[model samples]
Target: MSDTNAIGLHQGSASDLAAKLNELLANYQIFYMNVRGYHWNVKGPNFFELHEKFEEFYTDLLVKVDEVAERILTLGHKPVHAYSDYTTLSRIQEDKDVHDGEACVRGVLSGFQTLIEFQREILSVASDADDEGTASQISDYIREQEKTVWMLGAYLG
Candidate 1:
């Protein structure tokens, strides 16, 4: 068995958790910026409605980015804060010049898929590490995002 860290999480597991959290942070940063781009650039007859929706999504993403960075700190790792760092580590990339309503919604759905996958990975590792705080936080995200995926899917149809 691995030794536990000072924070009561397993040392090797905590280190791995921190690394994964950093990856999650990177993805969130990219996703947040992407949504912000969507908010700013979305156009069509649906502009008014989609603009507000994108704003709501990006704002929520910003909060999650902060939470993920803080969680990394709690695990005894510094979060990578630079955009360049995010670009390098993130699976999600910054979307640019995407003004179409349908495209923006598709991008959001794709980003959410990536997010759910990352959170699920984090959940599994957190559970193994016995890190209830991390597990609970990601679990909440997965549930909320799943509902969002459904609602957004309905919007797309």
Candidate 2:
């Protein structure tokens, strides 16, 4: 029998892909919570707009969180689930009680930046592993987020 993972990918490459995916999962969880905080705490003139936007952001993040975890499972690996693990693994740090709309937008921009860069790195690894599923997934995220980074930058200026 061939050395293959649950998803039929080479065992070693799938293991590496699952590990990188868990890292992405960790960052997404923290980012989701940060956006939740921003949605709840944002105030002032743009409250309604920013609040709604943050809600949309968090909701989308929640979906990706599930998708990433499921992908890890498909690769024959357990996804890291604890908040403690998330906090330790995530590159995006927690944002506490941010009420200013501009500040929240800046935070979102920073998150997109981190995610895009990391996703690109993952894409490289996925390509090397010949894991087309993971490569396609990360590519879509990077493409969407690059546009978001541009729009958020415009919002800031």
Candidate 2 segments whose C-alpha is farther than 4 A from its true place: none
Flag clash pairs in model 1. none
Q: Find the candidate with the highest TM-score and give its number.
A: 2
lDDT of 1 by residue, 7-87 (tens): 888788889999999999999999999999999999998999999999999999999999999998888788998989899
The C-alpha TM-scores of every prediction are: 0.96, 0.97
Against the unseen true structure, what C-alpha lDDT does each candidate score? 0.92, 0.93
Candidate 2: the clashing residue pairs are none
